[model samples]
Target: MKNKSVGIREVAQHAGVSTASISRALNSPESVSPALRLKVDAAIAALGYIPDAAARALSSRRTRTIGAIIPTVDNAMFARGIEALQRYLSLQGYLLLLATSGYDPEVEFRQAQNMVSRGVDGLILRGDTHTEGLRRLLATQRMPFVNVGVYHPDKPYASIGADNEDAAWRATRYLIGLGHTRIAMVAAMSAHNDRASARVAGVRRALKEQGLPLPDDWYYEVHYRLDDARQAARALMARPERPTAVVCGNDVLAYGVLLEVERHGLQVPGDISVMGFDDLEWSRHLRPSLTTMHLPTDEVWTRAGEHLVKQLSGQPCVMHHEVDATLVVRESTAPPRADA
Candidate 1:
């Protein structure tokens, strides 16, 4: 037979306290006497008492739940972060509701509204490209939300993100250090993405620092797909005076670049060098492991969860968090041979 769940009343009885005291001890430990709180906790453990989330929410007029909206669940990078967030929130008597917008702004807004209507105490959004209506709604509702994975200077909201600009700059500078002057960038479309734009800007900054201009023909922006990236790589490398090194916007793109490089009868780091951003799990296992920028995913998610928890509890949070990225040198990046 299935074991019946124990209720707060049973815990209260076991602790020799009123149900109200049990509730206060569980919800707001600071408001209860230490001795009584200990008794309540002991009883709860003994009985395996679990609070009814819905009932508690109704009584408190606040849902101890957070909603997170992201581009997609297909990406391992996001998968790691979101999983960590949910696990941490679960440990603190909170729940996480997740939504995927598939990188569509309109869909993102609708999902955000759905989460708000569902009575999430706080929200976690992916970026700052939200529609004006969505932004206004959040403003009018006075929703405590944090933007993750990107940041904005003029925006009056908290954000946690990696330093994409500096990371891309380092990637570009690494190629430059390899004696590759003719460099090319295969990047994602930055139309609605500040992170993508920042990456492109970082590459530009690196070139400018070397008194060089990013030639128009050397840059290509495509959708975030390996096939598209491969086609773009093929086209870029087919030029009569092809770039000696290609820096991709992400590790996925870099993987495509490496595949197409071999298809074009070129050798990596010898015929052409390749570098990527976001050192994914498989990046290190490549034939010539990808030399890429490593995002501080674990730390960023930890800080973001902490910020969201504070916001839900009406506590002040460090509004802006700028985590750094590191360069992981691998076999894919090397000096240009004199013959080339």
Candidate 2:
């Protein structure tokens, strides 16, 4: 196909200037005089010489695109965070390319590599689960990225997250204050999840402070599924020495617990109290108005966006960005009955 079209040379001729001057006027306007820069710009528009974006990026070394890799879009928590990030990026003359890794650490690393190769100006990640090998690769490539959900205490990377330990401790203490002596936990696998594990630690800390030790079988390690939560809740409740209250890893798990308790003809805060983390939107709307630790989703997202944009603009990111989670007391939690 013989396509006859205008090029930079034609535009330069139309502007009555050398190609080098036109290139400077288009690529680096600050280096060119105003009178000539305007002339080259008019010529460019008149000739319909659409500049290749990739070529422009290569010459100017900027794509104006940022990448955000999250665990999964299925959860409302991550969805809200990603939305805030995208909105903030758009206002700053940057675009966001989102990817989901389905909570797989290896997949997160691969997605990060792919985003880097695609020439993103910066990247945002959900947690610190990215393998050390991937970290090395990013460092070697000089790619700029920030951790959004969790923090690494010893490192200098930018991060924005709530105090998982404190949130968990508060939730547990609330349960204890309500006279829940035997408390059980239904948690997602925390081996590779620093956030989940920290939450669990907070629960233990509260228990230890209260001179209580969790039963061996009280800790249910399973995937974060409602069905699994239901089955696990049933098993826990069926035990001879069941907990008077249950603290779920998240709202989804708490919902499952409520469902299982209802099926067993048990009333929440009557027979048992149930608490959950991450005050999901539906938490307040639920029948019992769930009691949960309200993770500052909006704050977390806004701060992460601010940090990433600042870094991309060659500004120093805030050293310690920690937000507190608010505890919402609702109808779902109460003191355990003496009878169990």
Candidate 3:
């Protein structure tokens, strides 16, 4: 005959504890004494018991899994963060279910609801634009949720991210200090992306502080695609008087801008300076390295995972964890040409 599966009752009996204690140790380890928890763990090991996830969910009313909904993962920035989140969640003995929202609020709501319907224990939403319906659903279900990438502490979910405005401000100020007053910006659409919105504000704030004028044509808005970025850059450069310095929203946009600049036989930094955000992998390898902000994506996602795990385990968790990005100066930025 095949060996029987080691059930919770069997482990409890072997450990000289009630089934309740075993279940408590499994569901909420913080509620159990360390000594008793150790005993339970040893018993589980000796018996080679594997908790049936389905049965455990039935008993504890928890899926022991988290769902994360982000914008597109076409960029490495999002990919790196999601990878870190999955690794951390796995280490904590929980699973991560991910979905992409395509930066659409309605799609976000649908994916969020779908994840919950699949019985996720907690949820992670990106940006600051959680739908009222989604918020109500999470509130009504009493599920723990956190918003990553944008920090809005006064709101319901705990947030983990950098002050995007500050990061952008630093990037812009660096360019201004290089004596490049006519700086152009190549940015993603700011419709619903809080990061994009804050970055735009930061650029504007820095320029206004220095009494620099930002002409209407100096700002180009495009999607995350390089094609769009390339088109935007080409168009911006075609203006009556082109900007000497261009600040791109992210490395992808910066890469496209650089390509456009090179296509026209223009030099980088030597003729026009360029700066990018996100400090992506390829930023350093370019012929003229990129000057950009290094976002702590891995750290941010890891901390968010830990926060959700703690909340799910009945352990105390920090309500909000703020992170900051560092400005990296590289070959892509410099003082404008003397003739300009």
Candidate 4:
């Protein structure tokens, strides 16, 4: 049997505390003494009391829940960041509600509206590009939200993340420095995804700076699936003049390129160099190991969570915080051979 009828007053009576203390313990444990909190906890446990979240929200005008909208939950990089954000919010006595948009602006807007209707205290969004409706909704509601995975200081909204363009530029420069003029790219679909678009732009900027050609034939954009990436690699290899190096959008894409290279009877760095972004855990353990740009995913997401917490708590927070991504060179990339 369940005690669905247990109330705050019953909990206060059991703990030998006033109703005000019970409320404080439930809502703001930090404001109350440890001894008092312990008593309240014990009492609640003994009575099996479950506070009504709706009632609490109505009274406090806060749900203590933060909503996060991400592109996809399948990617390991996003998984790591989401885990970090969830952990940080839990420590701050807040809950994390996550939604995936499949990289669609309309879908993201709908999800944001749903979360806001459900009474989330704040929101954490991915990238700077969002539907105007979503932006207007947040602004109209005065909702506190921060964009993660991209840092744009000039943007009116708050943001905390790495500069995707800069990271990709550095990666392209590394391949160029390795004596590879014939470079190609296997990137994610850039439509409706600012992060992916910025990566493509970065590669172009770096190549243009060196007066290198980035013909339409040299770049292939596909979904983030292994099969898609493998197909793109095949198409790139089938070109009349195959590039000596391929810059992947992320480690997963790089892995697919590596596989396709093996299937084509090629050797990494020996025949074709590969560079990746997002130093995922498996990137380091790949057969030849991946040379990648290491984004501090956990740190960026944790900071985003912290920023939302601060904003909800009426504390000052930086509008834009930039976390740098470092290049990690390993077995997957090297100078191209000179043999004809």
Best by lDDT: 4
Q: Determine the C-alpha RMSD for candidate 1 after optimal superposition of all C-alphas.
A: 2.8
Model 4, span 1-340: residue lDDT tens: 4677889989999999999999987776557888988898899999999988888888888898999999998899899999999999886778999999999999999999999999999999999789899989999999999999998999888889889999999999999999999999999999998889999999999999999988898899989899999999999889888899999999899999999999999999899999999999998999899999999999999999988878776778889999989999999999999971
Per-residue lDDT tens digits for candidate 2, residues 1-340, read 1123777789889999898898676555555788987798788778777666687788879777888888778787888888877787765546789998887888888998898889987788877777987888789988777777765556777777877888899999999998889999998778777788888999999999999998878989667788989999999988988788998889999999999998999888798888999999999998888999998887787788778667766677785588878889999999888776
Please give, for residues 1-340, the per-residue lDDT of candidate 3 as tens digits: 1125778889999999999999888876667788988899899889988878888899888878899999998879889999999998875568899999998888999998899899999988887886888888888989888888876677656999888898899999999998998999999889879899899999999999999988889898899988998998899879889899998988999999999999878999887899999988899999899999999999989988988988887779988887888999999999998889
Clashes of 1: 0
Q: After superposition, how far is residue 58 of candidate 2 from its true place, in Å?
A: 2.6
List the candidate 4 regions with Cα displacement exceeding 4 Å. 13-17, 30-43
**Candidate RMSDs in order:** 2.8, 5.2, 2.9, 1.9
- Per-residue lDDT, model 2, residue 166, is 84
User: Against the true structure, candidate 2 has what lDDT?
Assistant: 0.83
> How many clashes in each structure?
0, 0, 0, 0
Give candidate 1's whole-model lDDT. 0.85
User: Considering lDDT, where higher is better, how would the candidates rank from best to worst?
Assistant: 4, 3, 1, 2
Best by TM-score: 4
Predictions ranked by TM-score, top down?
A: 4, 1, 3, 2
Q: List lDDT for all candidates, in order.
A: 0.85, 0.83, 0.88, 0.92
TM-score of each: 0.90, 0.84, 0.89, 0.94
lDDT of 4: 0.92
